[model samples]
Target: MSDRSGIFAGEDPFAIAQGWLSEAEKIEINDPNAIALASVDADGLPNVRMVLLKEIEAQSAPSGGAFVFYTNYGSAKGVEIEQAGKAAFVMHWKSLRRQIRVRGLTSREEGPQADAYYTSRSLKSRLGAWASDQSQPLASRTALMAEVAKVTATHGPNPKRPPFWGGIRITPLEIEFWADGAFRLHDRFRWRRPDPNSAWEILRLNP
Candidate 1:
């Protein structure tokens, strides 16, 4: 792994991903933590959208590690992911000329971690979570605002996290690190495994 200009010089893909993200945070103009999340619907149609990555858990015994983010459980992506029980995402930083892609199994994190993250958000956002019927048809902007106002009043200042809002964790089965190079000859190293419990098989791929 170290041969690829030392960028992928790590046994742990989670650690490498964390390192690349840290570098991106220093130089990327905005939303350095953002990832393009992908999921598939019941009919096997694909969907992708941008979301801020909330955490990158290091590799451990049981959980092994995961990428985490929050969203409304009833949203299109959430429903899609639940249907497929799998997801993928890509983190691309133009400033660093690097990208990391991950494909994995999905699971819910609706316990204390989800609650804590929800509490850390702004009051308006917490209320908004309770107000909007995400990915569903809305009558008008006025109607949406009115719903928000109603929820604000009902939930008050320190509202609890909505039952339908929580974290989604993606435990990667394959992770690929890619960096741009001279003459478009990029470097790539992929860590693949059948499941989280299995050992990784690393490969250097032609770019």
Candidate 2:
């Protein structure tokens, strides 16, 4: 007999994830798409930060399925991901008392999809992306505003996505869904595979 039911009913982990996220967006106070992205540097030190998840591609996607987020290709996380070829992230919703964790191989998403997402941002955000030298030291806030102004002037009203800025997609080999339970217990289900192309082997973890 299986315990998985209700919210954990789906066979496709990606679809289940999308369902959870859609529910979270209605209750989460802010940034429902926020994920704590984790990566490692060349020295093997761990790095983690909050990033807004841009998309959750379905299993039918060209790359099978992925979690997508964008950043400056020259940024610290970006550089580390390129060096390590892997990353992990967890998206938790306090309101729903649930979380989804993923570990996976990464690749750049620098195509037309990136362009369309860049175009969807507000003008100021788009310009800020062009202006900011992410992960680099800036002298001061004033200097940053000045740079923003410079880019605003140079790039005009409709600037293109910077060559150094785009998306990164993580195709997970492991995905875990967890929800709180009573009396300090928790429910956890993990779907893992040897590779992205392999069938997931599901397991229930003690929590």
Candidate 3:
């Protein structure tokens, strides 16, 4: 990592990721924390969708750092992650012409942290989480809205975070950083380790 400098200079990949995202937030028009999450179904079919990245835990975290995002446990992405025990994602910033990619093991974060995050959301979002049986068929929009109304009635002003909805933390085994370069010769670096407990092996890859 002798050549690492500027945006890429950091002892922890999670810290570097946070710096890039912070920069993205200032220039991106919307959803600066959005990431294209990838997972596989029970049949091994691939699924990808955009999800907002919620937290990039620091290296000092008890789990040694991770990327966190929330979703319904019954959702397609959630079920896929549970079945396969792995996932990957990419976050790109068109304004900065840079992107970061990660692949890792997955686990649920449905505890006090999940409840705290759920509480921070708008009331409507909290109720919507209770109503939506994500990745499942719904007869019509009206039916869905009615269900939302019913849940709102039952839960009142302060509904508990649904057990079915919570966070997912990805403890990455590999992370790659790429930046656009002249004549399509992009600058690329990948940091990898066999597991979270091991030291990273950095490689500068040709692009």
lDDT of 2 by residue, 1-207 (tens): 188998999788999999999999999999999999999999999999999999999999998999999999999999999999999999999999999999999999999999999999999999999999999999999999999999999999999999999999999999999999999699999999999989999999999
Clash totals for all candidate models: 0, 0, 0
Give the poorly placed runs of model 1, Cα more than 4 Å off. 1-5
TM-score of 2: 0.98
lDDT of 3: 0.95
Sort by TM-score, best first.
3, 2, 1
Q: Look at candidate 3 and tell me the lDDT of residue 132.
A: 96
lDDT sort, best first: 2, 3, 1
Q: Where is the poorest 10-residue window by lDDT in model 2?
A: 1-10
What would the TM-scores of all predictions be? 0.97, 0.98, 0.99
lDDT of 3 at 29: 99
Candidate 3: segments with Cα more than 4 A from true spot? none
Listed per candidate, the RMSD to the true structure in angstroms reads: 1.2, 0.8, 0.6
Comparing 1 with 3 on TM-score, the higher-scoring candidate is 3
